[model samples]
Target: MHRPACSSYLHQLRRRLLLLVLLSAISAAQGHADEFIYNSFSGADLSMDNQASVIDGLLRLSEGTDTKGHAFHTFPLDFSNNPIISSNTSSVPSFSTTFVFAIISDYDDLSTDGLAFVLSSTNKLFSSSAAQYLGLLNSETMGNESNHLLAIELDTIKNQEFGDIDSNHIGIDMNSLISNASKGAGYYTPDGEFKNLKLNSGEPMQVWVDYDSERTILNVTMAPLPSTKPNRPLLSIPYDLSSVLPNTRAYVGFSAAAGGIPTMHCILGWSFMNGEAAALNYSDLPLKSIQQLRAGRHTYKTIIIVCAVLLPTLGIAMIVSATIVKVRMMNRLSKSRTTDIEWEREYGPPSFTYKDLLAATSGFNDKMLLGRGGFGSVFRGVLHHSKQTVAIKRVSPESKQGMKEFMAEILILGHLRHRNLVQLIGYCRHKQQLLLVYDYMPNGSLDSYLHTQDHSTTNICWAQRFCIIKGIASGLFYLHEDWEQVVIHRDIKTSNVLLDGEMNARLGDFGLARSHDHGADAHTTRVAGTWGYIAPELARLGKATKATDVFAFGVLTMEVACGRRPIWVDGANGEPVALSDWVLAAWRGGSITDAVDTRLDDYVEEDIELVLKLGLLCSHPSPNARPCMRRVMQYLRSDAPLPADLQPDNLLRIGVSQELRMMSVERPMSCPATTITDLSKGR
Candidate 1:
């Protein structure tokens, strides 16, 4: 007789639970020394600092007074120390700590300074420092590179001189008062919602700081007092502390200061441990929980029995739920791919049902197809509700890179509001199908007007074309230098440039866009962008710099002016001639106007010649030789003069030939040599 399926499943689960119980019992039997330092400040033995008094069962680090003072608590910090913060060649030690702290304002509704948990090589506090400096370091000591210090600041007062986010923020500082990474005071709920917690509420709050040295990931979790620990952390950031700290030995203590609006800084229970130690949970703290009598020697027995019984049931429940969800999703995906209406309310964007899109485009008929790209296909659609025309990009399921591009478009374009940048209205993520909706450009991509034989129908006037050029320059300037960070539009071409209702150019398609820190040396191993648009140096080093984006813009500029693709076949010799080379050759021959599109006979000769020369200058092979987008904009607007040495030989030979000769680009010797690889192709 064969065993029943249900009984067989339960037998397997029982075996797994029994093995888990045995493992738990073994772990419980093992004993280790309690090497952690913990203090609730309930006894007369003042360990942290003699100056810090135990007042009302709390450690008072500072009083709300104007008089400057300093205090520090230190222990034997060396290799022999139990909880020493150490860094070695092999691996850095990990630690976890938790503490309850309160910063009370001296004046009504005002707190002047803040407090910090500092880890330093020395035990001494900066005596000259107070208020804004937070008693950590003085001006002279801060300027020294050897002043190795790391601090986690719970700031209650804004220091305008130091560019703080606001009065309420938690920041990680290295050597200086300025924060390396910071965030406004908030705690995350289990449902992923952020709840703002006031740091100056006068009420104490619990903070848990954990570092996994192996991963170099630091997490900060916080919650209002008397509340259970938050399942999610407020801040989880990556930082390698070993690289910044001086050595294996360091002192860890608290520092506070009083400014014009003085405040009291107090710490109520504190605990610190090293070597992947776990801190006491917030719910288990004496301040938050009721004391319960424990039956001697049965703690391990009770935990094992409870876990063994609960584990199997919990595992089975989870499996059943997951199976049901998968079945339902598959059914829904096959029958009707409509997105839930609740998504609009949840994310604060107008929702377009997948069914409505199907109806709008007649089930994605070929007639509705506008264009196709590496990631997805764009279709013209009309919203049935508003009857408004729109362009929808249906990402291909097989395109693994399309999902990233879809999300990038939503994140970048969703918030960016610009006259020259395309607007992202809404998006849909239903199973494997991803889609993005944007305002329809009836004129279609600029590539069709420039390269295709359909130019006769579009017939873009030189005035409009010049405006398009200036418009693109302004857009590139915004992305490269104006916005908060340097947004490198990795793919910039005539195809990505869209025209609006008034025939004004709008730079669209930010799938390959990357926001780089200003003044930071940025390099990406995963090189992205269209082939011809990618910069020459990118081929050698595989780094996407601001210069790379400028190079692409230069190519697009030439393409718009000459009404030709970056790489096109010559009519006379049937040889491929890069637009940049053709323009440079024409300029050398002393008839640069001949390079302008023949359709633009009514164009101004000098203006056309200026644009052509600007293109060559921008698309220069040398990344350093290329002008920044801001400078390019100025030159285009006539606000700045072109260089005196903007001659053909000088711009082409030194900037192009010399740079190209050393590069590994596909077409190395070709003027403006380029390779056409899709952004999705791996480097």
Candidate 2:
């Protein structure tokens, strides 16, 4: 034993002597055809930004316990002396880098956001804000091809906005802030065994990144301490770095961000080469302090080693115990004594924890609120798992009726699927707070554009307005007849119609909807629905039927056509007149074109007359007089001719008398004879 120990000491001394000679020669060649940089942080030249500092001989990019902030540190890579590889350059070069890092958080019970290794044209820190943006790129630079940047992110928190694969993973980003691809964090052992690693476990890990310009390929490798480098890289991606990097050199660094949960990202050591392939001597690395830190974690290491050895022996028993415990816990959680838990189980959509929402919505800040309604207030948030932008509705906690309505909406929309309907993504319940998640609609409700007096920012055009009408009709048709059961939408108004990214309408607010069997006499005593849009029969008899929904749809159609509310208060006389009554009187007097909104300068006059006439037919006093939703949809699409009986003579019958002459002089007959000319002028 004594002879072996002596031999080992001599070998270590000789290796150190050889490393010193090799490093001297490497330093001489670094300024010319190649470049190399290495930092131990104990006493090295490292340029840290204002948000970063050197703590305990390690570079700390973010505060030890700070949350909702960003920090960055850059290396002094002078482009004038050492240029980076680029497509515009005469010869694109290859490079490799190795880094040792450790991530830790004050709060261990909850995971935290993490850091990234970046190469960028600008040396600025915190180019983006905190949270999912990761201090690398902001909204302006995201997905911008001109922003020369490349990053390898070791993320510990799953932010949906960044498209994180998991809570702990490795991702590759180019130009854009969001990762193009990512994989679960792990390492391969010498025996080719795979071991999952957690970046936020407060453990140190070593990483290697190599770029080959010839093959336009990039490779990333990782390993836990006390282990040698793997024979093969864990992740090898084909990337044309020359296209992304600028002709000028770039600044290399690390960036970290935190939101509700903070993390301390530290770089214990780093080494990089920018030119030709040079042998890496891991033995020459300064790792005495790192070794000491690992020694302190012997207890955890021993436990992990023992577990790895006994995994096969105890696998079946552990699986059985885990499954039994999981089932019992799920049952208990889902069957709790509250109605919320029952709704959660019955709906069975993904359930987000209250903490997750708090972070996503920035502690439910007022700025995050999208809008408010009678039942609840809606807020916008970015989900951590997918980086998806979502709208969250929080029901009023004190409203017992609102709670019932909330449950009713979930039950109605959970199983329904249609492009013209809002999607129910998930929900959250904590103590007294109840929240529902939905896909965000960029354009707000239809009421905003038609009623708001601000036409300057109004996004709806004449053609889009017409399409919205047809889209709403399609949704109502589905609710009333296309689905498995008949659904009566007690409230059908402009406010209930939401616009998607493409400005197509999606009928929402199903709290007042009721499902029943077709051909069954279904009646409700509940007095629900908006005032003017409510059918006359529903108001007097307090009954909800398919015809009642059609009546409301008719009122909505007039509102869209005239760009007015269901009830209009005349400015000239402080008297309120129902919009349907005013339009019907205009049609009777041969002045119906005057009721059309003058704001719409570009529209087919014939289509306007048809919609006005249809509105009057559907809003007739008798529910049976209204056309079915299917017939209304067909009329809007011009798939079928209007019923002769429902078509009032004043609207269709031409007498060729003084009345016809006055109608033509007022609105002008720009229909069949002038279709091509009018459409061309409008376009």
The number of the candidate with the highest TM-score is 1
The lDDT values for all models are: 0.69, 0.69
What's each prediction's TM-score? 0.49, 0.47
- Model 1 lDDT tens row, 522-624: 6566657765566777766668888888888888887778886666555676544566887888888888887888777678877787788888888888878
lDDT of 2 at 86: 53
- For every candidate in turn, the CA RMSD to the true structure comes to 24.5, 16.2
Clash pairs, model 2 backbone: 158-384, 159-384, 160-384, 160-385, 160-386, 160-387, 161-387
Off by over 4 Å in 2: 1-341, 455-459, 571-573, 647-683
For candidate 2, give the lDDT.
0.69
Model 1: lowest-lDDT 10 consecutive positions? 288-297
Candidate 1: which pairs clash?
A: 531-676
Clash number for candidate 1: 1
